[model samples]
Target: MPPKPKKKCCSDKPACKRCPLQMMKKGTLPPGYTVKKRKLVKVKKSDKKSKVAA
Candidate 1:
C-alpha cells in the first residue's frame, strides 16, 4: 500500500484547476443535471381483457 504519487500532469500547472475529470472535460457538467424525456404508458391490449376479468 505504498504506490500512489503520480497525479499532477494536466499540463503541469495550477494543479489543473482542481480537476474533476478536468471540469467534466471543460464542459462544467454538474449543476442540477437533467435530460428528462419520459412517456412510457404501454398497457392496452384492450386493457388486458379488463384486467383478466377482474
Candidate 2:
C-alpha cells in the first residue's frame, strides 16, 4: 500500500497566513513545519483556443 498523501494548504487568498506557500515565500515558517508539495494543474488547449476565437 502507498503511504498517505500530505494535506495541501489550498487557500486562494493572497498572503494567506496558514498557507505553506505564503509562509515559504515570506520566509516566516514556524519551526519544524513541514512544507507540502504542490500539485501542478493542467490547462486545456480548448479553453485557450476558444478565447482566441472570440
Candidate 3:
C-alpha cells in the first residue's frame, strides 16, 4: 500500500494550505468535502500586577 499523507493542523502548515474548509471560507473549495475549522487567535494580556509574590 502507498504511504498515507502526513496530516497537518494549521493554515501555515504546507499540507493544510489548500484544504477544503480554508478554500470554502474563501469560496475556492469545490463541492462535497468537509474540514475541521480552527481559529488562529491573538493572545490576550493578563490582568495580574507586574510584581511577583515571594
Name the best candidate (by TM-score): 2
Write one digit per residue (lDDT tens) for candidate 2, span 11-33.
67663455666655666554445
Q: Please give, for residues 19-47, the per-residue lDDT of candidate 3 as tens digits.
A: 54455466654333334444322345678
lDDT of each: 0.36, 0.49, 0.45
Q: What CA RMSD would you report for each candidate?
A: 16.3, 11.7, 13.4
RMSD of candidate 2 to the truth, in angstroms, is 11.7
Residue pairs of candidate 2 with colliding backbone atoms: none
Error of 2 at 12 (Å): 1.1
Runs with alpha carbons beyond 4 Å of true place in candidate 2: 1-7, 11-15, 39-54
Model 2 global lDDT (CA atoms, 0 to 1): 0.49
Cα deviation of 24 in candidate 3 (Å)? 1.8
Model 1 per-residue lDDT at 31: 41
Full-model lDDT, candidate 3 = 0.45
lDDT of 3 at 8: 33
Residue 40 CA error for candidate 3 (Å)? 18
